[model samples]
Target: MDSMLKADTADVPARENAAERLAALAYDDMRRVDALILERLDSHVALIPELARYLIEAGGKRVRPMITVAAANMLGHTDMAPIRLAAAVEFIHTATLLHDDVVDESGMRRGKVAANLVWGNASSVLVGDFLFARSFSLMVEAGSMKALGVLSAAASTIAEGEVRQLSAVKDIGVSVDTYMQIIDAKTAALFAAAAQVSGIVAGRPSDEEAALETYGRELGLAFQLVDDALDYGGAAAQLGKSTGDDFREGKVTLPVALSLKQAGPDEAAFWRRVIAETDQKDGDFERALDYMHEHGALNATVEQARDHAARARAALSGFPDNAWRRALGDLADFVVERAY
Candidate 1:
């Protein structure tokens, strides 16, 4: 906790629109990746393309694919293979989001109605499967078995993580370690793979590949931690989803877990009723927020996130001092700062 607090106070200059800056740095490559994504989404089945496009066209940061292309470029690779792989990473991410919205029963995504809400759950699921298949095809075309294996394993791990999270939901007894494992598998695995595969395709050394993977993994953890904190504190429009969605869904996130650990008898009963029993009342979400703040749960979670963000920035220290690496470091800072 001391180390996390220290890291949280360290100077990391905030950037305006950090993700947008990263996107701009990788703009040309991303343009190609976006084109390739649209091309791959094409199908003779009109409904297939229609559903996939509906979500793809809806604005999102496309951060995973940005990491893929940026890492490759940072490694000085000027080839089409990375572009193909970047597009593949985007497809994988998009597929996961589609599946996740259904699983989470989310009504909004990226400020638009979730695909599952607009289309049927069945349509969203099938389209997600279709996008997943397209991702594999793109991975195969990229001509790197190691890269393909990495992405495939990530996809599998994500499913396992989701299952793990589902099993833990409404179980207020979940530890911080267990919660970390869930986010690592559900969110960080793909970010790691997205960065690692770039080095694989670039034919970089094992150490650099390891570094990039570390950067992505830590960044992903920070990203999710901040998102969890935001669910309680952020505006719905800013989050592109409803605040307290996690509460309503009975998902036990880090803030909730921390608050539960310090709960007095009355607070314990409150948590159990809202989370374990899923018997939430009108003011329950507000009360939960109050408990989290009283327990310093949100700050603790943000401090942990700041530690991870610092580690993510440090992972890039080994790379050459270049625009790519600096942007990545800034992005890590941005991940934690967004919670503020």
Candidate 2:
């Protein structure tokens, strides 16, 4: 397991590592946005503030907020609105993570103990609500009804997607279309909103706004697909969670869906029984993985992710050639390359 983890980790590339990639933007602005995120996250309530702070400090890649900033900069907006929007996006995202941890009964996040694990599910859920409300307040401060519309719709879509995924749990007959819908709503919607809101805030042309939205949606879809793949392929320690955690939870993801579709009758029956019964033994996960490997479902899912990455890159064609745009492309590639 350790050797496999090392191998996978080694294969993943760092996103936006080159200094030249970020040279177009003023580092001072980026630092300012970082400070803004911290400052806006503050709350007077003792427990909520502490718990929210714990989750914020848990070291996410901040990819969604970065997308907002990059998109705004690409559209020639260097104002504080972008910074506030970036922080707003992060707050929304972090709230979702808190709720997600409770739903998944997750014990760890980004190699640290999860808020729910440390503070209990009730506390985590309430703090998540606080963040959600705070996110909307921040958006209101942005003073754009268009921005509010986009973000509010995204939030609703994400909820619907979560509910859809819950309905599909342990159901082996879940189709690729269903899987795509779930991911598009749950994962890609916020990315689309983030980029679109940035464009809206910058008063970009309709075409530019559409392009940014497309880029964000495709990038987010690809990111989640890679994440689902890693959940099965990654090491438990490196993932900061258990391997086959999704399977154990009876969550049907893309790779598993494809594998089920391709499985022989006996293998299909085994999957149905294990999943329906929620009786996942070590051998059950191994068998499911072996079937996925034999049917090339894992590779198929990876190919799909690569296709989305290509689409995301193509969406950036309308943007001017600049360091930020180039770095956005690099970031898309990194999403597919990350091991966990």
Candidate 3:
């Protein structure tokens, strides 16, 4: 049963250590990005830095910023602009997490207590705003109006996506298309901007810039799709949050949306009672998982993620055949592999 939820990537050579390879390749640049993140987190307001650091130091993979650094390195960029943009990317992501935890009323984030739980929602939200402001400052320092424009738009798009998702909560009627659109904005926009901004700062060709954007967008989609599937079938240790957080929150994510479509009268009533009505009871989550598995919803979601990951790798084909390109490609596969 667990095997059914794993991503099918047998044709591709196994790269279970793809993230480690990419990290090793980009270690020095990542160190600089990390330093920049901590330095900019400073503030006289005391709680600002305290709260920001709480979330920032909470052991995220820094995947978004790493894309910025790796894309810049792949383009042979030799300036500090990539480092600045990468830090800016991390800030944007951290800011979003702070706000998301508050909205979701999340208890845990990255295996630790959510910042909002310790600092209160008001403090978490205000500090998130501070980080967003700081991100723009870094973008300005990076000195490319074009890059700034791209990232600024991404930030706006992310806000819109979150609001859209919030509005759709507990909506069993949400289509898979609607779910994709929501994630594209909420999760994938930053990834696209993070990668595209590098090409902008490096003054790469427009076509290459487009490719990077596509790669990041597709990868982000795959990443979120896998996350949706994992919420039902993955270990809490692997997810960094409880396995059924989405179900408990009544989030109409990809799996729920897919399963709802395939449900018959009895299962449909069960979904309505548990999800739409929020009358969840003991074993409701297990029943939901059973419905998803019975309908092959989890497997279907993972297959869709694999398709997106393949497209993400294909988007990198125009780039130079270097270690950076291969690492990015492998990272796409790794995104889907997380479902296992």
Local accuracy of candidate 2 as per-residue lDDT tens digits, 271-316: 8887766776668877877787787777778778889988998999
Please write out the lDDT profile of model 3 over residues 1-340, one tens digit for every residue: 2332333334433333677678889999999999999999999999999999888887788999999999988888958999999999999999999999999899999888899999899999999999999999999999999999999999999999999999999888889999999999999999999999999999998999999999999999999998888888742224343488888888898888988898999999999998789899998888887888787888888899999999999999988889998999988988887777
Q: Write the per-residue lDDT of candidate 1 for residues 5-38, one digit (tens) a residue.
A: 2232325332335665677789899899999999
Clashes of 3: 0
Cα lDDT over the full model 2: 0.80
What is the clash count for each candidate, in the order shown?
A: 0, 0, 0
Cα deviation of 327, candidate 2, in Å: 0.6
TM-score of each: 0.93, 0.90, 0.93
Give the Cα-based TM-score of candidate 2 against the true structure: 0.90
lDDT of 1: 0.87
Local distance difference test values of all predictions, in order: 0.87, 0.80, 0.88
The stretch of ten residues in a row with the least summed lDDT in candidate 1 is 1-10
* Highest TM-score scorer: 3
Q: Candidate 2 at residue 153, lDDT?
A: 96
Query: Model 3: residues >4 Å from true position, as ranges?
Result: 1-16, 234-241
